[model samples]
Target: MEFEVQVRGRTARRWIMFGMIALGAMFLAIGLVLTGVTASFLSDAKRARGSVVALEWRDDDHGASGKTLEHDTPVAYPVVEFTSADGMPRKFRSSAGSNPPSYQKGDLVEVLYRADSPEDAQVNGFASLWLLPLIFGGVGLGLSGAGTAVAMVRRWRS
Candidate 1:
């Protein structure tokens, strides 16, 4: 009471898929390690009334200002400079971002630090988001390996 699949086409394709799986897994592992290192070294350093040293850009003023949440308008966000709990000066910013920060210059903001290393930190609260990509990469790697292994075994028996 079992269903047997009769694979067709090129048998060599199985080995190719197996190779791809191994390669994907390798990339996945590397990505995981990188994200882990980053998460370990630095995190969202939540600071109390953390002072904003500068504003890099202005998102959306809508011609409205004064304690109002930033809107769709384009503004400048200043690069905020602050001292870590360890008394080390740090520059907080959005990654790969050319635009400005949403907050105003000299604005106080919150921060957080990596679980392993508090010296390094990020301005955004979602620093832990780094794990998402890492997790996805790991899954992709594992799936690829599994697929390859299954195919190889099937081909071997065939």
Candidate 2:
């Protein structure tokens, strides 16, 4: 009976350790992806004058009836049109959106893009360019740190 209890305890410890490692890996992966994306965006980034073609809304629907629907602050992605360094006309939808709609049709804005692939672009601004990577990287670092702390504590205790 005592031996069985000991085996069970060991199994539980292994499972817990595995869980911590898996969680840490997941966070690290997220951090790496965000860092890579940010790096890619910054590489060969070119700026151009563009105009917002329209404010598009992504709507969210609420509970059971579906008749009672709620809109998620009416955020809109700016559809920007610009000419690339190679003089190719390109239009892209900025991934960044905001509540109360940040832009309107025909609004002039700065656009940042890669010369090689102008279709891959973003509206030139701090939020559009940097917010996601910063937030994701910060959270990932926090989670990874916590996981490492847990592992170290376990090793010390053992």
- Pick out the ten consecutive residues of candidate 2 with the lowest summed lDDT: 66-75
Best by lDDT: 2
Model 2 Cα shift for residue 133 (angstroms): 2.7
Question: Which segments of candidate 2 are over 4 A away from where they belong?
Answer: 1-10, 60-74, 104-106
lDDT tens digits, residue span 44-113, model 1: 4345235667555544434444554544545554465666666767776533222343566666666655
* Alpha carbon deviation, residue 111, candidate 2 (Å): 1.0
lDDT of 2: 0.78
TM-score of each: 0.46, 0.71
lDDT of 2 by residue, 81-110 (tens): 899899888888888887766888899999
Write down the RMSD of candidate 1 (Cα, Å). 10.7
What are the lDDT scores of the predictions, listed in order?
A: 0.58, 0.78
